[model samples]
Target: MLHNFTYVLFKLKLIQPSQKAIRFWMDCEDTDKLEFALKHGNYKTRKLAAEALEQIAKPCSIPALLNCINDKVQNVSVACLNALERISPNDELIKTIVRKRFNWVNEIREKRAKYEANKHVKHTIYRWRRTSKESYDRVKEQLKKPIR
Candidate 1:
């Protein structure tokens, strides 16, 4: 009962505790509490929860960690990624990450194409300028010597 109350206080911001303490509590094998913390806790708490889940290495925690992979906080996402790696996620998680990776690659390609298209003339001029001076002079002389 006291443990539950302390947890509630922690959740409600009535108490601020160290991440080590939170990690110790999570090691008690309460997946529900760990999941809740992962989903709703502050970044540090979420990170600790992910580490605890990694230490537990329970397959059941895979889904929760997978869901956290897209967390806005980089630390939380990194922790979740590390936890997922340690848990040896199932095929679904692998497929999801692959799909997301492909989508990200496609997006980057599209953006690069757009940028290139927009700057094509500038790129050509820059490339021409970057050539060796001898090659540039040869090209200039060739252009000056008009065809018969």
Candidate 2:
């Protein structure tokens, strides 16, 4: 069957997972393929899946996107956060994640300014702080729109 063939190709990396996800987005009503890409594919695949989900803005993808916010890769996490903003701006989970990240950024900034931290920790925190601020801004912009 075509499904088995596609899965084999995906597993072999013969076809990019993102491309597969896009194909599924166009051909399927459900997000089974996209969710598979997010869960099993590489970081680039996960990022692309998030982007596709954002474009689709399907409510069904919200839960999967929410889980992606915790992805170990920064790019994947950011993509998921942005997708969540597009899909459900008013969701309490989105609000909580954005607010938490924003507050964490503030705390990092204050700590970095007030105390002398290890060089590695400082570098890591700096990156996280910057990303958190950007994510907060994006979520805030999304929230500004009147709920439909």
Candidate 3:
């Protein structure tokens, strides 16, 4: 009865899905749903989905995580970075790429002054943000059919 009620609420879109809801989807090994949440959910939900992807550690999730690694929200971006770090350690190229992103994320924070003043990293961050959003939008359009 409780499950049905929540399902009805979700179907009606009465409230945007919560992080815990996305976590449940993760436990079901529903990567498609996680990808959708990572793109569409608020920062909290996106972070949760990224952490879930980290735990699930599937190669299929890398693209979705990459799409959001430049998230404007620090928490969400860090979560994505962590997910990418764990998911692709065996792949040298991807590991190097994620390391660069991890550095970029750190550089923007004033607390980490090492590269914070680097103009090149600052510009790259903005460019990556735009590129990531565009790719996410494209994927979102292609997946127009609702999740089951």
Candidate 4:
């Protein structure tokens, strides 16, 4: 279990809490190590590591997470996607989904776009005519329904 690296890592004042720590994680190079760091590493550690590794858009970590896509737990895939998306948005996995127009990704993006556009329109309308709580709730509830 690489306990030496893990334990010594936290205690080292030599490495600042930000970029230095991230570089250490990146140097680990092993996708398994990176994945372990991502899952078990502290939030600031994970977030910085993901961001740093992302700018480089290393391909190693992306494939590691791809295998996790089919994980039974929904959040596992979501987290995998989140990490992979950060690491490399243009990576094949994302591009494949974009190219294929996978229903899941397409629907989610479309729904989010629609909701944002609707919210802007509603906000403008509300400025002119004060929206009732009931009316706003009805609109929001209606938007929540799955598209046929």
What's model 1's lDDT at 26? 67
Give per-residue lDDT, candidate 1, residue 80.
Answer: 81
Note the Cα lDDT for every prediction shown: 0.76, 0.75, 0.79, 0.56
Residue range 1-148, candidate 1, lDDT tens digits = 5567767887787764457566666668877778878887888888888888888888898889889888887677777877777678466756577467446556867998998889856543444454588788999999999799
TM-score of 3: 0.65
Measure candidate 4: CA RMSD. 15.5
Task: Report the lDDT tens digits of candidate 3 across residue range 14-43.
Answer: 755666676677778878777877887778
Count of clashes in candidate 4: 0
Compare candidates 3 and 4 on TM-score and give the better one: 3
Which ten-residue region of model 2 has the weakest summed lDDT?
119-128
Give the Å error, residue 68, model 1.
0.8
| Count of clashing residue pairs in every prediction | 0, 0, 0, 0
Q: Rank the candidates by lDDT, best first.
A: 3, 1, 2, 4
Candidate 4: where is the Cα deviation over 4 Å?
Answer: 1-19, 41-63, 68-103, 120-148
Question: Of the candidates shown, which would achieve the greatest lDDT relative to the real structure?
Answer: 3
Residue-wise lDDT of candidate 4 within 25-88, one digit each (tens)? 5666544545555545555555554454455456777665565555444445455566667666
Model 1 TM-score (2 dp): 0.57
TM-score of each model, in listed order? 0.57, 0.58, 0.65, 0.38
Tens-digit lDDT track of model 2 for 18-41: 475456654664477777778778
